[model samples]
Target: MAGILVVNERYFPDDELEPAQVGATSFSRSALRCLWNAGLSAGVILYKRAEELTEPQIDLTHRSGFRCATLRFNFDMGADTVSRAIAEAAARLCAAYGFSSRAMLYYQTDALLVFHPQELACCVTHHGPFVHDFVETFSARETAQAFGDAAKALHLFKHQELGVNSVRSNGRMFVLQHSQLQREYLISRGVDERRIRAIRPPIAPPTVSEPLRDERLRSFVEGAELLVFTAVARLDYFKNVELLVSGCVQARKQGVPLRILVVGDSAEDDVARQALRAHVPEELSAEFMAVGKLTKSQLYALFSLARSNGIFVCPSRYETLGITPLEAALSGVCTLMTDSEKVEARRFFPDAHRFLPSGDGLADAIGLAYASPSGVEQLGKELREAIATEISEENFERDTLSAWSYFSQSARQLDS
Candidate 1:
C-alpha cells in the first residue's frame, strides 16, 4: 500500500469522537477521514498512557476502513520511553501497512515524534510539542512558564541535532498552523512563511435534542435593547472567568446595555461558579447571568434567539481552538476574543474584536461595538459567512489530501 501512515496521540473511533476530546481527537480523525475518502489505505498509530495498558505491547486493532496500532508509553517520563514505543510500533505498522522500508510517508496529526525521516508529514500545529506545555489546559500550569525567546531554542536545537521533528522546516514538509500568530511564531523560528498555512479546525455543528426551556433567559432576551454576550467554559482559573466579570462590570458602567450569559460549570462541582457569582458585585447581579450548563441544542437555540444582537466572548488565559466563538459564529453571532497569542481562534476576528486579555481592554472592545451597533451586527453576518466558507468540511478534506499528496511525492522522490 503506497498510502500514508496516519498518527495521533489519543484513540477515539473515527466517527464516535466526543466534544470534550475536540483538539487531539479531531486532529488525526480529520486526516484519516480525508485519507479514506481519497481511497488511501493507511494505518493509524494511537498513543496512550503507560498505565492505561496492562502491558507494554503493540496491539493491531482493525477498524471499518483502516488498521490501528495502539502503543503505550509514559510520555511524562520523557523522550526515551516515547522513542522506544514509536520505534517498535512504526516497524510493525510499516510492515503491516506494506509501507516500503525505503520510503515511509506519515500523515501525523502532530508531527512531534520523528525518530525517523518520517518527519515529512502534513501536521497540525496546535497539537505539536512546541506549544503543548504552553497551552496550559490544567490549573497547575496556569501560573505560567518562562516562555522567553529562548523557551524552545534549546529544545529545538536538541531535536535538530537528533533530526527529530525539527521546526526548521524544509520545503518537503507541510505545517498547518491554527492561527497567523502561530505561523508567525514558526517563521520567527526559521520556517518559511510560504510553506506555513493557517486554518482553524471547524467546530462541529451543534446538534440540539433539547429545546430552549428557560423562561428566565427568555425574559432577559425579551427585555430592553440588550446586547447578549455569551461565554462558555468550565468555571476555572484556566477559563479566566475573572476577566469576564471585570469586563462586564466596566461595560455596564459605560452605559452599555449588556447581559453576560455564561454557559458552563466546573465539570466536577459548582464551587468555582459560586465563587465567580460571589465575585460579581451585588448591584451588577441582575446583569450577569450564569444560566448553568445546557445541552448542545439548547445552547445553539439560545444563540439563535440572541443572534440579532449577540456577541460571543472567549477570555481564556490560553486556548487552542476557542470553540465557543466558532460555534457562536456558526449561530450568526460575532466573536470577541482575548489575545490572539492566547486563543488561536482570535486570528479569525478583526483587531477591534481581539482584545487584550484584561478587564479594561474587554470593556473598551464592548464599548466600541456598542457605539456602532449596525456595523458590529453586520460584521457578525460577514464573520458567519467567512467561518462557513473557511472552516468547512470540504476545505479540511481538500487541504488534508493536498498535504498528504505533497508529502507522499516528496517521500517517493527521496526513495528514488
Candidate 2:
C-alpha cells in the first residue's frame, strides 16, 4: 500500500476547543478517513510552533504593502511574538517530512500552505484566492509569488487538487467557478492544468444508527405551533446569520409565527444573540433562540426533529456545497437554501425556488415556507427517495476507491 502524509495546522488545547476549531478539525479528520477507507495508507502531522516566522523565506512572494499587512496581523510589536506560529510550525513539519520528495499536503486553508513550497509535492485546498489574495492578509507580491511558485512547483511538484463542497452561483459566476478560476489563474501563472483536479466534498454518514434527543429539544419541537426556521452553521461571515435573523423578523412581520433555532457559536461574543435581542422586534426576537455549540447527539436530534417537521433553511452568502442540507435530506427534512444557480444544492433538489434567495428575497421565502410547511414535508420525501438512490455507502466506497486509485497512480508516477 502507498503511504500519504496529511498535514494540518489547527490543533486545539482541550480547554480552547471552539466550534470553528472543531469544525475545521472534523473536516480534516473526515477527509483523511475517506482517504484511508479508500485503501490508501495515511498519517497525520500536526504543527505546534512558538514563533510565526523565524526568517523571511521568499521576499518576491509578497508585495511590500502586503508584507507590511502580513507583519501587522502576524507579529505583535508589544510582545514580539508571531501570531502565525501554527502556520510556521506546519511549514517546518512539511520541510522535515521532505514533502517535495514524497508526500502531498492536504491543507485546511491557504495560509498554512503558502510559506512551504519546498516541502510539498502537491496541495489540496478548499477555499481559493479570497484568503491568499487578501490585501489585509498578505502582500500582493507575496500572493503573486505564491501562485507563481505553486504553478512552477506543479511541474516538478506533483499535483494540486481543489475540493469544492458546495454548488452555488452568484454575481455572474458560480461558486464552483471560484475553484475553476483559481486553477485557471494558477495555470495562467504557469501551473499545469493537467495536475489540477476538482473533487466534490463528501459527507460522512451519521455515526449513530438511532437518533438521540434531550428533553429541551423534545419540548421545543413538541410545543412548536408555528413553523420552525432552522439553521446550523459556525457563526461566520460566510454563514450570513444576520440575514437569517432579519429574514425571520420579516417573516414574523408578514404574520408568520416562525420560530428559528440557530445552532453554533457566534464569533462576535454573543453579538448574534444580542442583535436578535435588541434589533429584532419583540415577537420575532422572542421566537429566536441562539443555542451555542451542540454535541453530535444534540445535532442529530435537531436533524431528526427538523426531518419530522420539514423546515430547514441555510441562508449562506456563499456555499461550496452545504453539507447540512444533505444531512437534512437524509433525515427526511425539507430545506431552503439561498439561490446560487451554480451550486449542486439546486441541482440536487431541482425545486430550487422553494428555498429563499439571497438579499431581498429571503424574507418572502421564509414567509412562504411558513405558509406551506407540508411543502417541506413533500420536498423531504422527494429528497429522501433521491438521496436513497444517490448517496449510499456503496457509492461512497466506490468514489473513494476511485480517488485512491488516482492517488496511488500519481504516487507511482512520482516514485518513477
Candidate 3:
C-alpha cells in the first residue's frame, strides 16, 4: 500500500497536540483533516522554531486511525538555506523509512522549495505565483507605491516569474480553483493544463450544531459605542489588512459606525500592525482592535457573537478558495470580500458582494452593507445554504478520491 507525505512549511495539527501549540492555518488544518478522512496514510512533515525543538526527532503517530509521521526541524538557519536543508532532510527521512515514489508527496500550498519539483504534487493556494496579474486587479503600480517601495515591487515580479517556472516544472500542480475566473488565471500564468487539477478546500462541520451567541459579547459591543466587523487571517501582506484599515477611516468619515476586530497573527504581524497604525487617523485610533491570534474555541465564540447584520470581511488580495469568508458565512456573519478570482465568495455571490482592495472601493462596500442591513444578512444566510448544498462532506470525499485516483493512475502508467 502506498502512503503520502504531506509537506507544508508550517506546523500541521495533530489532535494530540496542545491547543496553544497548534500553529496550522485554519485552511491547512481543514485540508489535513480532509486528507486523513479520505483514508490516505498521510505522513505530515512540518517545521518547529529553534526554541521548540529539544532534539532532532521523527515519530510515527496516528490520529483517529490515520497514520502519519512528524518530522520536527530546528529553525537555526535562514529560509533560503534552510529550504534546501529541509528538502535533503526529508529525502533522507523517507529513504530511512522506505517512503517511495509510489507514495506521492503533497504540498498544501505553492511551496515547492522543500523538495525536488518533479518529485511531488503542489497546490497553489494563493496568487503569489501570479502577483503581477493580481496587482493589475487592484491597480498594481499605485498599490505598490502605496505599499512603500521598489524592492517589494521587484520581488513580486521575481516571485511570479520563478514561481510559474517552478509550477511548470513540477510533477503535478493542483490549482484549488472553484470558478472559471480562477481557472483561467492559472492557465494564463503557464501552469500546464494537463497537470492542473481544480479543487475547493473543504469546509469542516462547525463544532456546534447551533452556535451559542454569547450574550456578554453583545452587551460589550453595545456598551462600547461601536459596531463590530470581524476578520480572521494571518497578519500577512496578501491579506491586504492595511487597505482595510484605510477603508475603515473612509467609512467612518462617511458617518458609518464601524470598528474592526482582527484575529490571527504571525512573526510578520508587527510589520502589518505598524502599517495599519500609520494609516489610522488620530480621531479613529481606537476604532481598530487587533487581538492578535486566538484559540479555535475563542474564534468560534467570536463568530457566535456576530449580529444579524454584523460583517466579516476578507480583504485578501488573492486566495485559493479562501476558507475564512466561508467560515464567516457558515457562522451566519454577513460577508464582504476582495474580488479574489479564486475566492468562493465570488463563485457563489454576485459582484455586489466583493470589493477591490482599495480604500474607496472597500469603503463603498461597507457603506452598502451598512445601508441595507437586512438584505446583507439575507445574503449571508443564502451563502451558508449554498455552502451546505454545494460543498458538502460528500462532495469533498468524491473530489479527494478523484484527485488521488488521477495521481495513482498517472504514476502506474509511468512505471509501466
Candidate 4:
C-alpha cells in the first residue's frame, strides 16, 4: 500500500475554521494523524474553484507539520473536464510526495469534482451535494443569497447529477456516505450499494473555550425564562433562518417565554440575516436575536451558561452530521435538531427535542424544554454519555483509517 492523500475543495490553508463548526477539515486533519500513526506518509491536497485567479495555480507548501498541495482553477468548465483536471493534479502530487501511482486518495468533500476514479485509487466521502441545499431552500433564498437564479440552480443540479453518477463509477473507487438518508438517495439515483459505506460523523467532547461575553446577550438571557442557543456558521438560506423566527413567533403567541441566543454572522449572505429579521414581529423581536460571530472560547462560555437554563437548536433544512448539536449535548445542554432522516442527530441523538421542520412543531419542541427543564437536562446528560461510550476518539480514528485501508488494500489487489 502507498501513502494517503486527502482532498477537499472547500479547504483553504489561510481560513480559520472553528473546531466546533467544521467537521470536514477536522476529519481531514485526523486522517493525516491516523496515517502517520500507521507509519505511512500522508498529505493534504486543497482544490478550489476560483474564477478570480484568472490563471490556474497549483503549488506545494509545507504548513504546520503537514505537507500541503493546493490547486485553484475556474468552475465554469464541463464536469468531466473539471473532474479530470483534479484527478490529474492528485496524480502529480502523489509522485512528488514519493507515493506510487496507486496512492490512496481520500476525497473529503462531496463537490464530486473528481470522477475518474480508475486513474486514481479513491474513496469519495459525500459530505453533501450543493444541489441538496439549493433545492431544499429554493423558496427561502433571495436573489442576493447565491441560489435564487435559474441558471445557477440548474448548474448545481447538473453537477449533483454527475457527482452522484460516480458513487459506483469505478471498480477500485469506493464511496462513503455520512448519513443513511444520503446513502439511500444515492442508491435511488442508481449508485451501486456495494461501493458505499454509511458512517455518521464522529463526535468528540469539546475542550473548554472562552465564554462569549456581550452586554446585549447578557441582558436578554437575564430576562429569559428559557435560553435557546443556536450557532450558525453562516446565515445562509439552507440554515432556514426564517423557520427559526417563525417558530419563535408561534411559541411567543402561545405565551412560551424564551430567548434564543444566535451566535453567527451573515457575512456570506447578508440577505438571509435581513430576511430573518423581517420575519420577526416587533412584539417578539427580543425573543430571537443574532449576536454575530464569536470566538470558539466565547461559544463554549455560552454553552456553559446553558447547563442551567439553556438548550441548543439546529434549524437546518439539510444537515450532514452537524457538529454543533453534539458539542452542545456534550456541554450538558439538551440539543434540539430539526427532524430529518438526513440528519445524524435523528439517528444518534435522543428524540426528546427532535422537532418537525415547521412552525408548530418547532414551537412545541421549545415548549417541551420550557415545561420540563429537568427532562431536557437529563436528555443532555444521557446524550453525552451515550455518544461518549459508543464513539471515542480511539474508536473513531480506527473506523476512519480502516475504511481507507479496506479500499486501499483492494486497489492493491486489483493491481496484483
TM-score of each: 0.71, 0.67, 0.71, 0.83
Worst 10-residue lDDT window for candidate 4 reads: 12-21
Give lDDT per model, in order. 0.60, 0.49, 0.58, 0.66
TM-score top scorer: 4
Give the Cα error of residue 114 in candidate 4, in Å: 4.3
Instruction: Using TM-score as the measure, name the better of candidate 1 and candidate 2.
Output: 1
Indicate the residue-level lDDT of 220 in model 1: 77
lDDT of 2 by residue, 1-416 (tens): 32333333333222222343434444454555565565443344443333565532211121111110112122222222232332343344434434433434444543333333332243444442343223334455544443455454342222222222111111111111214435544555444444455544455446453454457655666566544555454566556677777776766677766677776664346765565456567645556667665554556667766665546777765454566666666667666667754234455665543455543577776666556646666767776677666655555556544554564465456556
Residue pairs with backbone overlap in model 3 = none
Which segments of model 2 are wrong by more than 4 Å? 1-23, 52-103, 114-120, 127-129, 132-191, 205-214, 266-268, 341-347, 353-360, 373-375, 387-397
- For every model shown, the clashing-pair count is 1, 17, 0, 6
lDDT of 4 by residue, 106-127 (tens): 7775455344545666777766
RMSD of each: 5.7, 10.7, 5.7, 3.8
Position 322, candidate 4: lDDT: 72
**Which has the higher lDDT value, candidate number 3 or candidate number 4?**
4
Stretches of candidate 4 exceeding 4 Å from the true structure: 2-10, 15-23, 50-56, 75-101, 110-117, 130-148, 213-223, 266-270, 295-297, 373-375
lDDT of 4: 0.66
